[model samples]
Target: MLRKVALGSGVIALIPTISAATPVQESSKEPLKPPLMRLSELPIYEAPHAEYGEYIKSKAKAEKNSYLRSVIHPQVQAVREIAEIGIAHTESLLHTVQDNYHELRDRTEWIVQYLREEDNKEIRYGAVAMGGLTGFIFGLRGGIIRRVFYAGIGTMAMGGICFPEETKEIAKRNGALAKQYINIAYNFLYGVKPGDPQLEVKFPELSLPKNVSELTQLTINHWRVKNRSIASEKCEVECFEDLLFITILC
Candidate 1:
């Protein structure tokens, strides 16, 4: 119980920062554009076009040997499949949640119309009428019909006040779940636990406009190779701090 209390307090402390990032300001900014070709984008050029053209070509060609798959073990394949499934599922849920919001708005319009019939008066007068009608319907500690009417009016008014927020909350919840499935599934499959958790692998997301999906996928592949090289060779990767935002492979 004491541990739970501490964890709850820590989480509550984080609420402010989490909420701060999510406000409309984050969405209002324009996306940054890529300025130059990444290293990966450059072709394996001949000597005149590339400083180390011969070395680059021969190196890539050696790695493309037929026996290459022998080095890529089965476990890695399993994890890659899991990541692929997550990518598919998250994208699907994104579409579904987006659709549901539009449906909710349509339902809200229907409720508003039905509400018009229920309250013959305008909203300026309807508040008092609704309050009184609400009381009359439920005041007697009510009959079956009274309870239903009272609930309908109460639901109508409450939805008018809060349904938009509720709809947003629902969509947000679904989106979170979808992202969680992807993040957790990927981490569990790959065994590289998450430290700075964020929604990732947003399809086709890349700094460059052309071939964004391919570029991002290439980065993922490079990251995987870098990860393995580090593990097997005990080689520490240079951070390349200046190029942190840029793709290392490109």
Candidate 2:
């Protein structure tokens, strides 16, 4: 009986030891985490611009509650619409300016040629007067050959002496070409083909003013006043150069 009791006690002690030593079974349902990537191998991530298109789309998707989304959606949409309209109008105006510039450039080809001819004439005259090739070379320094070439414009009402019927026809053609060129340039710059309703979003380097009034003023100053003034100045400078060249030649 004593031996049996001693053996039973030993078995009880061994049972507790075995139980403690046994490895606990891992929960099968627990998910294993993916291994972390090395710092060097980690991809560079750029956050999307808050005001840009992608952010607007993502925000719409993230909101689950219908009430909150409904309130926010209209406001977000309004902002996008405003931006689109503002950008489109600005781009259209810019394209008009570009078309006008090119048209002016096309019209001035004859004057540019005359200036070039006058420059050559001055060089030759200097050579004749100074009785040496050195004088001619030096004279050519100030009057560099300005060769400006423009492709054939369909039609233009270049100011010149012409019959009444011819003048009227030229004016009509000029208007048509002006409209055509403006559309073409605008389409190319904006990347919106004919009949396409979408307006391209542009993120210019300069941030627009937060205030609606200030933004309007800024747009007017740049697109309306400043750009037109600059274009006029350019034309004036060219005309002055042509006049100077003619005077020198004469």
RMSD (Å) of each candidate, 1 decimal: 43.8, 31.8
- Candidate 1 C-alpha lDDT tens digits along 14-107: 8866334554554633223334566777557533344445556766787786357667756689999999999999999999998998899899
- Which one wins on TM-score? 1
Task: Write model 2 residue lDDT over 1-250, tens digit each, in one string.
Answer: 9999999999987874433577889887423333555767655683223224555565566765677889899999999999999999999999999999989988777544553454465643443333333334445544433111110111111222212345457767975786677767767798887778744433345554868799888988778887889999999999999999999999
Candidate 1: residue pairs that collide: 39-250, 40-250
How many collisions between residues are there in candidate 2?
0
Report every candidate's CA lDDT: 0.64, 0.60
Off by over 4 Å in 1: 1-64, 73-76, 113-250
- List candidate 2 segments past 4 Å from native: 1-64, 114-250
